[model samples]
Target: MTATPVDTRPLAIDARGLVKRFDKTLAVDGVDIAIPEGAIYGILGPNGAGKTTTLRMLLGIIDPDAGTRSVLGASNPQDVARRIGYLPEERGLYPAMKCDEAIGFMGALRGLPLKVGKERGRELLEAHGLGHAIDKQIRQLSKGMAQTVQLLGTLVHRPKLVVFDEPFSGLDAINQGKLEVLIRGLADEGTTVIFSTHVIAHAERLCEGIAIIAGGKVPFTGPVDEARDRIPAQVRLETRSADGPWRAALPGDTRRVGNYWSFPLPETGVEPLLKALIDGDAGILSLSIERAGLHDAFVAIAGEAAARDMVTRGGGEAA
Candidate 1:
């Protein structure tokens, strides 16, 4: 049988050899990304890994020292700025502005008329469960509520592409869950969502494709499952007998700790091993296969040091 062809969707954001420098420091080096339209993509990395720099260059927030990019089919990102929405890592809103007004202001910035922005802002507020705060001042809301308002503003214009940088930062567990739902909802509506996050769990849960960046360079990029497949699936077996002829069937690398024997699943498949176990009078108590998680894949692909840095930062903004 032929293997399934990889995703051939049209590109929403195509960037190649993007390089950026801040004074003497090389912030991003030769980054290339092709995000398929309507797919949820993630830029995963540790702090100061040049994720923000790469994003800024893609959005035309900053010019790359080298390389090229196309945003929403336009060679110049600014030409299509109205069709894209961005939420930077640093969140800010005028404290004196009412919630609806703040959201409207954001929409207006994206070319929506002030009146229409206000109307849509109110509707967005209601839709996101922030209607009660529509008339309230930004200063009066809690941090999570304020962040939600800013996020609502980002969506009020209904842009085709949305980019969020460390969006999960500063959010509590419940708010984080809500944000995940909101992101999936955006994708369900055919919006292309690209988010930069050091949190691997978020990328694993939401991203169809990801670019793993470390030290201002991309170490790996592609489907989430492909990354996970870099590490082998592990097998856990429990048997009534610790030693028997069936033990010989276990892979040489198998380890015994207490009552469990763990090892990488055999290439020949489990059927042969099960047969040997049964024939050798080894009473199997239980067995399970555990697929490798994104965390393990991250460590293998991005290196242990980069993975440690990611864990150390844990959702904080990149330097």
Candidate 2:
């Protein structure tokens, strides 16, 4: 029987030992990220966690101090820039320029001829419900309309790789939904899409894999389910009798959150503890194993990094 080969070439977006320093301050420190092709990857981080810096480095807008990075197999930014589309967190649009003109300009920058760019711009605008805004100046459009225009411009060239930095920031619920659908459609069509967001719920909904970055570093990187699985399942106990000894019977790591007693599953088994709670006259109002939530995991990792940075800064200040 022939053995199947493990395909482990460098990922679609791979950064190895990436470091960025400005004077004495290090923004991104020895970060390594690997994003697969045709995947919706998210970089989940709070503001100023080097997420933007990382994205900038990936797109070759800025160079790293020490590392190798590539996008779509192109090691040089100039060579790869044509194949990648980026929507930066800071929305940049020529306010006085008409919507059609703005998008066409961006498309032209990506090497599309004027006629083709104009036609493509119209198609995208009309398809995205901006048909009437073709002649309207960006200054005359609402924030949502402007945002849609920017997004349409980013995709007008059909770049194989799209990087969105906080793309959903100012979008309301309705527009956010529209953007989500558009992003999903892009990924479904084989675009290697990656976006950065501080919103965990949005990441959970849109990303197949994610890298949770905090304090200028990535603490978690993998598939969403794999990340969740790395966190032990919590056994939740809700009892009518709050005064029961069942709390003490559980492991030391077990915690009381509100009325629920959460005990992490033991390496060996939880059956013994389950039986103990039953035998102890605990009402057992609810007994269930709760999988780790993405928010919970993000908090756990990000909080640790933040606390460590605080302690380090405190020591430096005292010295």
Candidate 3:
């Protein structure tokens, strides 16, 4: 008998048919995903879109009503608890704890020796440009500084996988950019990073693969470019005259919006259409093609009304 070749690329997080309920409400429904090792993956959706519930399920914080999952190839997350790092959306820290001590404490919970944790914590804080504040109390730091300390704590043990929930919620523009760099750095160093965020721009710029969940269902998943392909490209053109023979060259579904004529880019290409318009003596004022973004993709996958509801983060039991 021939020996089979081994498959070495195992998924860091494998979840299938996950379902959860809170009383009569369906918090998560039939969710499934395979997060590859050494990749940056994102769970993106509006607030209460079942994103938090799904993360909770994956971490074994809350048992799923149905389906199964594995974390770091283990059947239970607790089995590999020390190998995974998690930063919940709700920030937590002892107000009186020193900056370095807070980070060490977080590592201690994951079984890292307190002495090692403290040393590593100091190293991380210094590297992150907070060297002067290492001994400051958590309550003494600014909001952004405190958040950074919490993030450093999450990585003090050097877990194989890390998850951040709404990591950008309160960050300023400069800090947000810094955090993006940090996440990328982690992935470059061979750590599998997974995060949940309502902000689509972060996923667009950082994630290699993403799952877009809404109303407890994932409408789209896979590569970022693939998700964007769901929405057709559009063209916007404006002419000095609204009525002319050139109008006939436009797509049948074309419509006038504001001062411009908008229509879907056709299969034949815009070159032919532009030539026809010029031949008909039309004055082309302005023109350009608009590529779809994540927001547009979300709206296309989930209906406009549902997307609107998502933007509002409807209901009190948020995901």
Candidate 4:
């Protein structure tokens, strides 16, 4: 006999046309997202790309000028805030406070009793490998240990939704692994996790879906596999494998780099190119088709968006 797996798809976080403006500057310009329950959804962008601003707006730290965002079915930020555990990018912990004190304070802020907060604090410190440093002051702990304390504090209230902003920053490889495990455990326990970071590689392993924002707008928002599928899997054939007419016969965005050639492939239909290469018979040495990685996709999409922004601004300047 086997137990049935629970269905975990629900709208944990939903936003439509979210816009946040500060004076004349639009920090977040009309973003929309639907994040499923128990899923890790990553928001990725470069510096000053409005990732932090979007998160703040969603957490009710700052109100959006236009559009609506809901966390856990409550369109009102204040109402949903109590059910959310948030770790902001700019971390703050009182240097004089002990690890237990800090964690208890965070839990108390989330409406837990002092005794319960203290007990949970001890458990988290141990779980995160900070048990030895539990009584130590925040100032005395190492940066990685302090980070662990902060992460534990966020989870104290058992919130259904957790928002982590650059959660892996300032941690060693070991600590990063620890954090990844903890995050996965949270999602497994039925918590929806959303995080924003500039590091795309971290998100590649940590998130099932990702929303890539650039210049205050989302360019890609879907499952990681789906996003990867949108880009062509390219193969490089670096050989002196043709006569002068070979350039024209090559298929789909082929470029000659040094003595080698790079070709961006269209999905399917590689038979024509394969036949041409064999027919040309000009000494083919090595041919390899590399599946387009997330970095390649990010650079392609983000670069295009940036170029468009530049052209738009250039036109305005000329006018």
Candidate 5:
């Protein structure tokens, strides 16, 4: 008998058929997700798409009206809560508390020793260029600085899994870049990082996989590249000859702007078209093929209305 190879990779989060309703509103319907261990995953959608509700259910902060979920293999997330670090969408810290104290308090809530939490808090502050504000009152720091302190607190316990709900909402560009670096570092150290965001650019740049929710329903979920691949690669062509038989080979939807013609790559592939263009003596000055980005994929998979909502609400901020 031949021995079978076993797949050993573990799942950090597994959810199936999740549903939630508030009165007449169906917030989430039949949503399923599987996230692998140590992966950076993103929950992307427009505003009011139940992204927050889904996250809350996963963390056991709220129960799903229907379906099952497991976090770190536990059916009840609270049973393993100590192993998870969560940063809620709403940022909050006691105004009178010192920066280090606040971080320590957050860690202590998750079962870390106050002394150790404070020590780590100080170190984190120093590493992130907030050492000078370590003893300052929360009210004393700027809004951006306070938010950073709270985020550091979320990691003080060094949990195996970290979940951030709309973490970049109030951050400036520089801080946003720093946060991205921090997230990457955590993943490098074998921590599973999950975040919910309206910003498609962040997901495109950071996530290995993503789940796109629309109107409280999941439209698509899988690897970032897979989602992007739903749409064909775009082609940009610049030819010296404006008119020729080669034009017949171009896609019907091809559009011209000045000297450049742009369209989706033909299904028959570029080789046949290139031959036709050359044979017709249509001088090809510049030609390039570019993959469709997450933005385009979102519009294709989630519908134009959802894409419009994303932009009008907040998605345009990072685009």
Candidate 6:
């Protein structure tokens, strides 16, 4: 018997120039995203930004009009489908089916036997605090519970890569936190987790790297820190008086925001400005700063049109 060697490359997904269209509308345009093994990557964009379309093409559910993609080191995504688990943006489950049965069915479809699926389903449900609902029908579960079960089904097969589309949608704050913990744990165990969301906060908190998609294209793809760097740091300071000699020392675009006066931190440094403010006999009530978050980064990376798109859409989805 001959021994076959395993390929130990760190890339879990390599895709470039992936384009897709529907009718006259181009859903995805020249988007390129590369995900490393065991990474928690987020595809972030607003509604109708072609996020779902991109994921579909990457998973091989739909063929791209142009470009190439490889999943799990294979040119054909279907060949590695069993190694990938997916939870779609839309809810999918047999309403009449029992919770355990539903999960087992999903597992079975990925090549696990019925009996093994059922056994694993029961164990997963129990381990995840859903043991009481072992015999509960899908229709009887709460919307959040149903969503969680579907997520579990996506994992029942123990896939190497898990793809979730809007997984945080419709979940309560507590459940959302739980889902984040779960996803983080999965990556710790060596499973690559990729999820798409319009919520910059979710991506900011959970992802190591992100792709900011807008207007059917990805404008930024890199580590979260790099993305945050796209936006300038904001300096927020509070003082005993709003107007004084400090005004002359203040940076050009200062504005009052709630309790603090804020302005874009100069690239030169904050220490010089701090010295100027202090030299002017400015009474510094409290000196603090607000770093640019992913929301700020999203606006900077996505640009004006996408910024309007994000803000008009509430800057985040319900999740």
* lDDT tens digits by residue: candidate 1, 90-142: 89999999998999999999999988888998998888788888999999999
Error of 6 at 255 (Å): 3.8
Better of 3 and 5 by lDDT: 5
lDDT string for model 3 (1-319, tens) is 2464443677999999999999999988999888889888899887878888999899888899999999999989989989999998888789899999999999999999999999999999999899999999999999999999999999999999999988888889999999999999999999999999877789989998898888899877777777887877899998887788888899999989999989988888799999988998788898999878977887888677666765676333284
**Displacement of the residue 200 alpha carbon in candidate 5, Å:** 1.3
- Judging by TM-score against the true structure, name the best candidate: 1
State in Å the error of residue 156, model 6: 0.7
TM-score of each: 0.96, 0.84, 0.87, 0.82, 0.93, 0.87
Worst 10 residues of 3 by lDDT: 310-319
> lDDT of each model, Cα atoms only?
0.91, 0.82, 0.88, 0.80, 0.92, 0.88
Query: Which pairs of residues collide in candidate 6?
Result: none
lDDT of 4 by residue, 129-240 (tens): 7889889999998888888888899989899999998887778998888888888999999999999876777888888888888888888787786677667777777766
* Alpha-carbon RMSD, each predicted model: 1.6, 5.6, 5.0, 6.5, 4.2, 6.5
As for TM-score, the candidate ahead, 2 or 4, is 2
User: What lDDT score is found at residue 91 in candidate 6?
Assistant: 86
Count of clashes, each model: 0, 0, 1, 0, 0, 0
What lDDT does model 1 reach? 0.91
**lDDT by residue for model 2 over 139-179, one digit each (tens)?**
99999899999999999999999999988888899999998
Off by over 4 Å in 4: 1-8, 237-252, 255-261, 271-287, 304-319
211-314, model 5: which lDDT tens digit per residue? Answer: 99998788899889889989989899999999988899899999997889999988888999899999999999999999999999999999988888877885
Task: Rank the candidate models, highest TM-score first.
Answer: 1, 5, 6, 3, 2, 4
